[model samples]
Target: MGFLGSVCRCSGALLAIPIAVIVAVMVETPTVTKLEGGPTFEAPADEVPQDATEASKEGPAAPRMGSGSMFDRIAFVYDSTNKWMSLGLDQHWRSTLVKDCLQLQPEDKVLDLATGTADVSILVGQQLRTLGAATDSVLGVDPSSEMLRRGVAKVESSGLDHVVRLVKGDAQDLTSVQGIDAAGTVADPSAGAATGSIDKISMSFGIRNVPDRPKALAEMRRVMRKKDSSRVCILELSLPSGETFLSKVARGFITHVVPLIGWVATMGSGGDEYDYLERSILRFPKPMEFAAELGRAGLPVETITSFAYGAVNLYMAKPEFIGASRTLAALQSLVRQRSVELLTLAMLREKVGKRVDAADVDFSAFGCLHFWIEDRGFGSEVNNLVSAAIACEEFGLHCVVEDEVWNSGRLHTYLQAEPLILRRCPDEGTSRHRPLEVRRDRRVATPGWFAVCKHAKGVSFAKKSKFMRRVWRYTTETRKRIDRLNEELRLPPKYIALQVRRGDKVAGNRKESVQITGMDFAREAQKHLSSSCSVVVVCTDDLTAAEEVGRALRSLGSPAEVRWRSRAEVPANLRNGHWQASYNSLTAKQRIEMTHEFLADVEVLRCAEVCLCTFSSNVGRLVALLRDQRTVSLDITEWTND
Candidate 1:
């Protein structure tokens, strides 16, 4: 009665169907089309039907894993064999794949590769249809035409005839498939790769069969959509690779016992040839190795759900950030070309701490503008980072960072590129890659200080916008944090943002803190705020200053609804990881917490209708970079940030 129950029943019925004939019947539910300008989709001889003499002439491809004719032999019995070998747990593994892919949108299309009799294909359709996702044609590609032929019938019988379609193709190179486009959109079957592509991919129990595993993975990366949630769910049969007792037993079952079960299932129907199944399973890479392979292909696995004591693994992956390859290739080329000796913190600690002179370092592999973010005020650090990144672009030098210094060495963070932290000891056997030591003037900001370290002729701003738009784009975590901050502040459709600075700012020069700074912010807000703009959000380090601003706004006879965040509201159960610089009286934990608080506050400031603050402070100057002319510095009569 339930939809999933209906799917299981349909799968059961299809599994029981026998391949009594290769018919001339045209199935209305499924469509089959051949890929043009590529290899023949037919399987090698040893695996094809006896009647197919032409394909048999091609001889059997030595790699049994990729042998389509082999799968064709077992096509009708494949699902049943899986049920027996997996102890009826094959469905559970696919259900996990479905669960991971539930983030799909209504308009997104899913590709099912190695769709034997369309089990995973139909199941995905059933699940997606339940969610009202478009299942009009969930395309399934396979290497063996026989496997696809049977799979087409299964799709029709499952009541997903309107949803699933099967075609013969190679996963190693989808480009070989006819009518499929390479431009990342699913197009008409008549077009080649120029037309379009699929959004998500699900390949169940077939990755092991692909002889060129990395190539197949790279093909997956090339065709699928690159949205943040666009994923590839690959269910692979694997050997149990653990030291646990249960793992050992599962390992034994796969190696010593599964082959016998498979042979017995064949009932002497080419039983000796079926030994290839055991070989394929044994030759399959371990879970970790496969995950690394996935990484190398630019599809980083997000989760690996293991089943049957690790006999199977469900890999869910997301595309690596776009242009990451280009960024790195560009950096690698530059580093090698310029002979810049890039050094990491470990190398630094080994040689010198805090600061090192360039004259003391040896010349080597690459020349890079080592981007640095110091433990200064949060505003100052980001300004330094952005400034240096742009500077790297301006000079056409390799733009990279030291590993320990990137995002302050926090894991689980995100970046546009792989961050390209160039670490080369070249030959610890002969070369110690000491850092490009700069005589840093501690008071100055980075890449500026870094520029001086490089002894640059000067700096330019031409590359600033380009670097910010493409290279220095914010991570999803950052966007999430900003959104959270906006929601908590309850930002209005129209409201001016006011910031009051105290602490070090008050002691710096003629600057004021506490109530005076708040008064300055409030007065500036009045200049930008008409009666029509009657809402103002105040951000401040000292609550006492915020209190002053609210009072000043009211005393100015402005009808603005004043809102400000308390120190207690700053930290949320958001990002699990963050980089904090140790300073003042705060403990390490408190320091990190405060960093989170500061980040949230600045994001709220960035979202303001108009900003009012002193440009003399780094926070005020940062507002100009984020929102440009929409900000005003109360200390300066003119609008200039200088």
Candidate 2:
């Protein structure tokens, strides 16, 4: 069986092995820094022979270091998942490993053998591109057809296709390969760069997946020059044995929670995929055991560093090159901050295009998308929509819009705080409240054509609260007031509703206390109205402030209604329901459909005749992305109130 297959098969048995439980109960063991030699020998010190009894009584130790079967299984899973699961951590791990490999020579050429998705290949190609390497110079080789197709699409889409090459080839027999240099110089011009011509070679998340790990390792050694110090870095997940309470909890989460997540993501109906994940982790060799494989392969392990409570590890080895590791120390100081992933249903709608078909849908595009917005006001809803829409249109990617408000300094803390925001969103009427497992039903209702726009933005505490209060009232009372207005005046949809606000009254910017700048524009809009338009409905948080501006604009002979809806007035106003509402409603997903029918009864007083809006407002950006009509940006610089 392949490495991953072995892991999947052995996961249940490994769990039963009770390795972590034993370590958890035992006191912390002091680790000896053994850089000077191989693993400390307690039993007979002579180099352990290849035919030693298998560690497990049931079968020969899982295709010992450098075994071919180990990788074949990984390739199988890689083919099955189509490379969806484990992408985030996989990318981060590869990036650190690539960084280590590149330290060999700022300009050295590197090959990421068995490079699934070309994670390592892309990094190496980037280094060559930075040095101005030509197309067809840097290459990535893998055996999986499915993985290659996806990797090729990514390279082409990223505009890196011209520089990086993704090829299907075996790592065990790479003695005949060629190399590309910094300036696109290929030694054997006919068949591409010649064999034994490459510099550094590294594999990430692939070695453990390989079957005959030793032969693959030795093959890597044969393809490089002897005098040249070839560098190779391997990064993989490991369950390190230690007695810290934190590590024990982390082990439990990995053994249990991780598989559950894997099940939801891979096998949504829920089946054996979760078992695959748990099995893979448990069946995975402990850190020292894996390092011992590199020794067998002839690429002696030089150093090992733990990351994320030893859940993952970065192992650096020299096929021949070994020196006091400078970057290893740097890795110790670097900290990983927690970031929430967001997806917008609107964006997903856009990516899947006008029609939704499971076959047409490329689900792999939905990797984790991070949401960031400058303002968390009503303006945020619009901005969030735009970000999601753009991502879906451009990347065909689905996002997980996180409801994150507070910033925690550490990754673990951020994970803990995420649930708080998710819980608050539904109560605020932003989206229906659902735990992560049930949140899929809360997607925003969008047009059929908009299905591809699947990006998500997190709502902050202050903004989400404000959104809930405003939405509840808007749907309930303010909705009715608009209905009454339409019944009384019989307004047309083409009429305009103008929202104006003072810049001074807005909240302070989170990172700095600088005042926002949309107030002046609102004050200045009165002078430039076209004679064709009438009856501007002004929206504002402060009624007194709205009237002051309304009176000033009225002085210029404009016919507009000046009114303010207090936070309390919303419920009553929505009950009247005789008026038209904005295209985007703020009601919770569950309640909105019923309210939408009421909203439809009211005609839009205006179709939006040249909207004068501030750029800082979320409403402004929303109008920019959604409204098809011509709208003008209300620049504050144009305002001269005097």
Candidate 3:
């Protein structure tokens, strides 16, 4: 079931040669850089006592090549080995697609069309389960029994039998009659036999193998549930397009190196067989055109995201009419108008903590919760944390900083803000800065003898660099003063935390760079957010960051609400909340967790509003999720700025 034999299952060697040669000539040569080294060399290049001139000799390593189609045949040779190789670049592609393409569910059923050993199906199944899907959610379908056998074996070996199921049948012919048992089969023999609508339908790599392309697509449409809530997904290899210099380089690599690797790996099988691998790639349709085919087949494409520099792409095509929205357009409109912001499961513990109802707290009269660290020299991290809290408050959350014992000069660092809550004055003057005190550090007191500041200030104590010694020292003192003030004021249970990743310029193994990467707002907001009343809504690009804040709040026995940019949407019951927004606004972790919520929110809407923007991470997920929710966009340009 490896690359050597994956393509062999498609056609015999004799018939595969002619196509291979023609494909080879048309196939471009892969460029390889040649390097030369002398025979044996003395230590010094300039002058070695005019004595030694032996040179060392070496050449560039030979290029290894393989084809996209080699993957299909290699399954026949050594499936396990080929599976890992094909997945080298494919793992990333799958992760991106799962996060971007479909609206997931915990228990929803998924049918993987053209399963081809059910690799794609299994991959999808694994992701779904990780996102909290029920184990029985994914099913695999393939035309080849040999391919199906490998999938079955994999499932049994992994003990994932309940999560993934494989059925042998042609993708083009999916009817009950088409499932001929070679003698005793009872499934879809008519091929394309309708199997009703499923939550998700995925066809990866296998689509190109089908002889009747249009028929296979049509069968996909026929079997798909007519509801506006289902997903029809397609992931496959594609050729590069023009207008860029790198385009030629990429083309060269694919045509030459790919086939070369195939020859080396599948040599005994047949060079021509591997040659067909090159032809298939050359002949595959452009992504846009392929998407058009899907539209024609009745599963119009909703999202098409390319990966690996366009070597592969994932297409999410939903049925024309999902649920009540008889047309794809109708579904988009419905989801936009009827999306939810937050879905919360408010909890209480056995401990007897005082209950604060959100309804009873008059924010206007109460003003705001004043939380400030005690110091003149401020901590950058502490200030950032408070800033985040302020931002959350703008969205209607609450926070408080308890401060009493103010250490002069340093207090200003912790108190600086938009409102300038605290003022500066001479220590001996009648106008004391505090509730203030005096500090001997003139470096901090130069501005004023005593200065008022917030009980909570930003600080970056986590930095390990030697340059931040002064800041770290101030942060430590500020925290100590805060503890003293909290005890003096007898403040209620509170949560104080910091976000340390604001300076990360790039993500691990990703292309985009994150800005405004702080979880402080969510952390501080949780302190005052009543465990029984107000919900602490955490919106951050990092879900783990938000969760950490939420966990901290939870430990204090407070109600914390966390949202991610990757989350699908609020469940149907929770859609009425005003917080409903796209996942792009939150962290990746939030988006993932929210996907579970969206999958569970299956309400059919009358009409939905549409917001289209350039396909950004969160925005893309939003569009995909809303489409699943049954909204149709008349045009995608209206609400999106980009």
Candidate 4:
């Protein structure tokens, strides 16, 4: 099914989001307080661990740290208190969060959502600078105006004004973070970083403060770049999930003594908010529960790590590049829904035709294997070839494309990809004239989806791209022809492109493929377009829709001469998603010529600033793999829980 109908699926799941870390100004060291039968901790004289017995009587419904006023009172000593409370480990935790969890790249644009006193923001800026990031890459957001006030002063004092920016915004909602979009640079800082703009998000010591944690989690996932290396790293204070002696001791210390440390560090000026820290830890969901919560929020946890006797946890979630592929939350829903059929296969893995498992094979019995070749679009044919490649590799079986497939029956004759491994069942060859018993081997007909599901692991984007390029390799003449077309169209060296997939619908009573309609690929493309986007190329079946995209791009009049190939045209029958069907009825020479034209279009689609296309189309998916596994899939998953 195409994603045009999936709008509700995504919108129902997403609520516009939060990353919030509140920071406190550091203070001088204070003397440690002596506890009975234990090491001394520098805590308030008026409070002790014994007082925590009453805290147990306190309900788990601790007040959520929504606004920053409560933290504003403790902001003065937040840093120093954390250092002392964690026995000088808090600094290391933050550093690890930045260096390890974030894994910041030189080009990454970061959002430290709950930046208090701008500690994380400052760290991110420094790391980004070290990486030689030329862009003003870090945006610090927090709701506490007072905390932001101090953070601004720190950011300026640290001489990172060109790198880090602090804005007043809530972790549960980012729209309030001034104007911070992709173009809303330091010069125009009011625009909040737009959705799919941020590469990394860091929330250090902020999750406890968020009442609507799922909302914040979903928001972070929303704002993050929908590509590989995108991450949301949250370092939260957690309770020990063990009953060991050290675990018990650490638990008691964190629950009872940490609050008093806040009180002592701030000299009772901190008010009762320090006690909320203990309550936040208590009210925090258990580690597994929180992990589940994250999955449900659409930020599927890729890594969960515990530090310091499980008192602190770093929860790392990364959004998949594709349409929320096999997320833990989605799998769990399936498990719950189909517990009885847990052993049953998904309907998508339908048996296309015959099956061939090599392990059980005695291939010596037959000389040639039967492969079900069909008349389908070039995308579909390539998909089956990919499937066959994987199946052969996994089964240790040699494949031969013998039959007339891809409609014209001699489809393989037109294709230039002479795979070293796959043998051609040639029409003129002696092998073609062999006896029936000498030719007939085992049959192999693995479905396209089945192959995808089975051979998913270890096939990285790089590997997949290399494989597809090999399968669709161009000849010298083909390259020359494409270049000639590109020059005639006056396409730029590097510019944005759109792949508007009208989906696969065949002619007559032939069971039609998925139909795609009423999509907004241009909307997604517009988000990434700018004055720097000098040229845009639209690759689509429907030139009518391409006309809309061309108008939209040209409407943003710029000094950088915008150019688009608007005179592009395709026959109505071909444009209606039946190119393969029409080609089958054509002569062999016409089929070859049509193949060349299609390849040129694919080559253009293969290279773009961004491939704004639907995941519903096979060609669009193929384009995604080639675009370094990055593109606006335009899947409507954001509107639904899927």
TM-score of 4: 0.42
Q: Give the higher-TM-score candidate: 1 or 2.
A: 1
Model 1: per-residue lDDT, tens digit, 232-313?
A: 8888878765444555667777777677777778786746545776767776755645664565566766556666657777
Query: At residue 308, what lDDT does model 4 achieve?
Result: 66
- Model 4 lDDT per residue over 305-364, tens place: 677657778877776444423432356565653431222223212222112111133333
- Which 10 consecutive residues of model 4 have the lowest summed lDDT? 31-40
> Model 2, range 11-55, lDDT digits (tens) per residue?
977886555544542332322212212321111223332322222
Determine which window of 10 residues in candidate 2 has minimal summed lDDT.
Answer: 435-444
Stretches of candidate 2 exceeding 4 Å from the true structure: 1-34, 37-89, 104-107, 175-195, 227-229, 268-277, 321-642
Q: Rate the local accuracy (lDDT) of all candidates.
A: 0.56, 0.45, 0.42, 0.58
Off by over 4 Å in 1: 1-65, 135-137, 178-196, 332-335, 338-642
